[model samples]
Target: MNLLDKFDAVTVEADFRITPEDKAFCEAHQAAYDAAIQSFHELAFFWEDMENTQKELLGSKEDTYLSSRDGPEISQRRINAHLEWLHRAVISNIVYHFNSTYHVSVRDDYVANNLLPQMPDLRIYENKEAREAYHKKLREAKIRYEDVFDQMLLLLDGRSFTEQAFHELAEKCHKAAWNLYQNKANYERKKALISFNGYFCSLHHYSWQDEWTLEDKTQDILRGVAHYETGSFDVYPLGFSELLGYQRSPNNEHEFSTCKKVKGLKMFKNGRVDIRFTSETYAAEFATRYLGLVC
Candidate 1:
């Protein structure tokens, strides 16, 4: 039989696998696929721009506020590269942000100022000279950032000393931080899921296959899926296991049937899930029903 006929011979199971090249191809293509939907790599530049702008604005506040997320900058050729990097970035981000920004990156633990006068538990051992030199460098950074923040706040209408302004900005920071924490969790939760693997198995393009390990964020809904559906409906994702027909709570019934019929599953590296509705109601229903029936 010709190569096309070989498609029928393949079966979907653990026994089936692609070569490393095929895996790489799938990863590459899936990255491209993700990029087409979500501008993840663009975030690298976006974050860089943000960092630069913030730094320039808060030149002295660097030490007072840890504004940097520790990762080398990245640039992507297209959406594909962005998508590929997104998977790595989100997981890294979930870890980084929790330790760097919020205490709740992990369960139970949270970040907050403590009563101790001791510095953070960061330890470095080397020659006394090296330790001294490192401390000096860090001190300089703190001074510069503190001064920068002073200048920036002063520039923000000279309200740096005002209690109301402090309260407002503090509230904003807390809210933004909370939102960031939840978003990371949502990503982590979805990332733990396994669904697209079903599609991945079905769409095995071993000859042209690209291995993809995806952690999707729903900011970009899949095209041709119910995420963008219009007309009447509201959608809420109950859970990932729900897709395979697993129900963990009675709350699942309240999940609006708006665009699920053909909904695209968004996965994240951390463990959180939310929903995006579609523009078309019937198509959405069709997608949700079809997947339910098929699954």
Candidate 2:
């Protein structure tokens, strides 16, 4: 099953007892649901785009038309790289935000305000030990909700990716693209293309690129730290000289290095860092050491 199916199944299990409070919680968090729907629609649109690009590339037999300034093979490789990047971006958005954001919000909000308040009342159980067990069950349920919520938050924030879900999405996009491309029925092709383009147009009013901003200080620092830790970076800040002192030296002309060093600082090559804690600590430590250098 796809991520959405799995999400729905878990939700069904999680929704064993739905009260008026739950309904109110969902209503309060309608914006989150709207965001998720928008995200999913974008994901579907990009999936079609990726598939159509692949189909076009595959359908072409002549190398002359595909040739660029580099060569036909190089040009083709670039196109493939772009298509792959597009697929990854779409999958990232879906796995991170589209699939679970609203559900997580609803679950968390419901538990916090509704279910948690009833924890003290143990009519579900008789003795003290039984009451404790019931409380434990409630806590466990909350944790389950939080665990998935945090995981999705991490994914959406670009701290991690759901590998299995991503692969599944990629496969689905490829299959759909191929099927549509290979379809000989003109009417069917026209219908499918229209549907695909319609979804894309629906979201065309919003610029996805605006979601990533270099001017956002918090994002810039977090992205810089992520790059420093993992070598995987985004376009944020465009440079890291101010925050990380990363600059190229004229003497070397080919090598880049930091201008200053901070003590008690450790860096990693793999594993995700908690952006909230790491970014704050890194900034404070750097500022302290920077002042020490100046003094």
Candidate 3:
């Protein structure tokens, strides 16, 4: 049968079973979950100690954090300071994971920045009546600053040290003690999958198997399911090759032509899968392909 025809023969339905190996691999990445939780805690800690005092203006109620609204340079200073503290801790976290996967640990920092900027200083203010509007702007500034951090935590909540990072490092470290090994794609997929929460299945799992699976320390198996499976779904477990618009000839079965990984795939620490698409069109096509969606 033709390759596409074979894909046609396979259809995705409810209650799919992911393989044990994949399941175990997912479970083995508990460090990632711990990293997420620790990262969240660290973020909250920083917000309470750092932003509340400096940005939030917590000492006096009427004199809230924005009472002395500094321009862009001041705000950026605060952000850089906050991120500096964040960098120190996350660096250690990444090192801890790499240490566990290998016999030795490195004291070096692998600074990973997940937070983005929200520039609130650019809002226009016109006159004395603008003083009334100024409060609103300040409030917006507080929210905007907090939002960048809040979402940054959310991003951290979705990530850990289990992706192509290892794929690349594994090859370099193969000759080193406590050797590392995984295919380039598999390593990349693992990292990408960690970015996901229970909201979506790992592309790592979806790419190689029908589902994401996990095993407990006792060897009990669990199949990862979508967090929100009730509503109509837009994408299905089609071969990533087709889903991502990757093109390659069959003769080079292992050959894939692109480095673009569809962003925002989801997963959970307990080892479950979820599906959320960045756009409806991609979702629709995925559903049509592997989900047996009628034309």
Candidate 4:
């Protein structure tokens, strides 16, 4: 049977199982895993210290820390100054650890590497109103974290890290290291698509608001019909032969040309893409090439 016909007849899920080699690779990077856990512990220590000091000075009063209305000006100054110094020390510690471990050279890199949960600024505490506003923002801001450090610190309730927490943190670190390996490996697998496969691949994920040059190029090259929805643009590469370069002869092309439909091609504003395929094989192929996988 024709491969495309088979694709048309079935659904496929990409096999993203961590192979033995991948597991071995993760094992090799045990140092990076250990370093990540240590980083989390250090941040948790700082957070606990901050929490204790804040409780001691404020005594359960929102209007007492640096509030001119509730405390003497000198008292407010002293408390604010001490808190500011502590905050700076904590930030400095985090910055130095990430720099040494991950070689994070810029502030944005911290966000990229999933290092810090909230990017706290001490300048927000420069005045009474500013301090109050900052506290309000913190109260309203959702507590969330991607890495173990942020997860533990944000959720810490002034208690010591228990053995279970340590075990859970270690488990999360293992998963994170494995995920990094998977992304690196899958990225390499898809790298061939840009070369011999005649697919245009971009590493930078474009925002919905940002100009996507690839959309224009896709229109110009494939001359495909583009349908724009409220949040996304779908391009049908009917003239895919010009871009795929495999339609010239069936002898030279893989099954991709046979199943040329780029149906339900969703560019998820992030650096990921998803396409609906009639055949599971095609779907798996497309998914392994484009979609982000988490393990």
- Compared with the true structure, what per-residue lDDT tens digits does model 2 show for residues 205-257? 13432111122222233333343333333322233443233321222011123
Q: What is the lDDT of residue 224 in candidate 4?
A: 18
Instruction: Please report, in order, the local distance difference test score of every candidate based on alpha carbons.
Output: 0.31, 0.32, 0.31, 0.34
Q: Which candidate do you rate higher for lDDT, 3 or 4?
A: 4
User: Judged by TM-score, which candidate is best?
Assistant: 4
Higher-scoring candidate on TM-score, 1 or 3: 3
lDDT (10s digit) by residue, model 3, range 175-293: 11111242111111132121222222222334544433221210100001110121112222323323232232222112112212222333343544333344455444333332222
Cα-based TM-score, every candidate = 0.18, 0.16, 0.19, 0.19
Model 1: residues with Cα > 4 Å off, grouped in runs: 1-125, 143-252, 255-295
* Model 1 accuracy (lDDT, Cα): 0.31
**CA RMSD of each candidate after superposition:** 25.2, 28.4, 21.6, 18.8
lDDT (tens digit, per residue) of candidate 1 on 22-124 = 3454455445545543444456457657657767877845642323376444332332344433333433333343223311122211111111122333454
